[model samples]
Target: MAEFPRTDVFSGPKKTIKTPAWEPGYIRDSKSGKPREIPIIKQLYDVLMKLPRDTEKVFTVPKITLVRYFQKALEGANIQDFRFHDLRHTFASHFIMKTRDLPALQKILGHYSPVMTQRYAHLTNGHIRAEMEILSAVWTPIWTPSEKSVPCEVQKSFVK
Candidate 1:
């Protein structure tokens, strides 16, 4: 599943990671069983452009080797219990929080069903806290009466 995308896949600003129809592997379209095109940002496009393209594939190393390298990087950084697949979860959570668009996220994640994308789109604690803060404006009183002052009618209306 960790197929390093081919250099040929890059078209202009976007780098679409789709399996070819004739030579297919993991990239499966849930609806058409072909492939989906996901757009890559300009930053990523620039970074990928800088890489040396000696081979047809963008990455020179094998898939397994890249996984090993990722694992090594995790160990070096003292990160624990993190997997490559976890990146999808992290991306989904941040994307949803930032964009607040589930449908857009589903398309980006290539989820055939919205349910699958929902599984990944978890709201972080900070994001939830930020959302709750929006309620403050609604609850705020337009005019706060003076605590020390009392109306004359109320004083007169009071029974001994």
Candidate 2:
């Protein structure tokens, strides 16, 4: 994030903004050694748009200061064992849950291999349940209980 250049946040056609990888003073990229363009959500775009563009870099905050601020905020919110990088994981998981598109995520994340993106993929229980509900809608029941038939003991436990 410290290496993010202001010029990288480009506005494309249709008012869309994307952040291209910026690795200033580096030969083979900075973080992951892979550079890619990542589309920014409207909310993030709005926030970034509000930042003062005084320097060539978008964010003037030092890396250590930002880390300390994040740690303080996390502690204030009673969050534990969470690092800044965890936000990437959360974003990846939510993105896959919403779009179900791994290839797109792989490109956005700048992963050279799909396996790296697969490692980031995680499904929430709610998302799994929602998917199961969709499957249940399409499935045909093979055996349904008759009105006169006695419910099984196990089934009785589920009766409301």
Candidate 3:
């Protein structure tokens, strides 16, 4: 009954895990009537591959289970204050840094607005500044007063 397809291609002693089922058709469950796809990841694929063949009940993997796994993995790695969601942040940050493709990143992150995607815009500051410098270099003052029309010698001698 789970909406997301488990892409795990492996099997374990528990043969019930490898069966494929249709992903539930998208539905509108809220007042806004928006449809959403289930979030799938490679880790879920691995876990599903190890499931028993006869498992009939839809298994729910909670966020806490992932958080515990994250904590265990980081226990001796010398990292501090890591959260499971930080993986998403790191993915978004690195993707933006490497590709500089805001629209692609926004789609990957499932954000509806570019404003939400703009959080990663700061990563392109170097490019942004370089562009601004390029624009500034091309722009120049159009007019200057004649030296003879200046009231003071200092003003008259001013270079255009």
Candidate 4:
């Protein structure tokens, strides 16, 4: 299902996209029954601030027009073979990597169940190594022959 952002706001930095479009599609998620509110981070807030509040919508242009320009932007930046949906995926992936918070991402992506948002999870390739690092010091072996031996008191405990 496609969602359109709601421009009407009385106060606060939250924005919502409502699903179940007038056009039909496959069942998305049970959690997607209601609109999802996204908190505005500094980058988004800055862009919103720059946009003219004179209009109701943050974007004055039509969705197609914006997509066309976004394509042009991709071309300018030498980004190839990417669609608007790819951008959403990229954003979701990065957000999950940075936050490691699945529920938060589910809310942001408007997924009713985290299972949908899990599709966006591309944890760092080093995730395993990063976790294994905690055990590195523990397994170092205090008395490896090449390294100094432990103090006599420490060594005696091991010897016993």
Off by over 4 Å in 4: 1-33, 126-128, 134-160
Q: What is the lDDT of residue 102 in candidate 2?
A: 96
Q: Write the per-residue lDDT of candidate 1 for residues 1-160, one digit (tens) a residue.
A: 1235443577889887653321122223334544675565666656665677665444568879989999999999999999988999999999999999999999888887999999999998888988988987578764444566568644654542
Clash totals in order: 0, 0, 9, 1
The TM-score-based order of candidates, best leading, equals: 2, 1, 4, 3
* Model 1 misplaced regions, further than 4 Å: 1-33, 140-160
Identify the runs in model 3 with alpha carbons over 4 angstroms from their true place.
Answer: 1-60, 120-158
| Residue lDDT tens for model 4, 15-84 | 5554322212222333335643555566665555566544444457888999999999999999898898
> How high is the CA lDDT of each candidate model?
0.72, 0.72, 0.60, 0.65
Error of 3 at 45 (Å): 6.6
Residue 7 shift from truth in candidate 1, angstroms: 13
Residue 76 lDDT, candidate 4, scale 0-100: 97
What value does the lDDT take at residue 152 in candidate 2?
A: 79
Where does the lowest 10-residue lDDT sum fall in candidate 1? 20-29
Candidate 4 lDDT trough over 10 residues, lowest sum: 20-29
Q: How well does candidate 3 score on lDDT at residue 23? A: 36
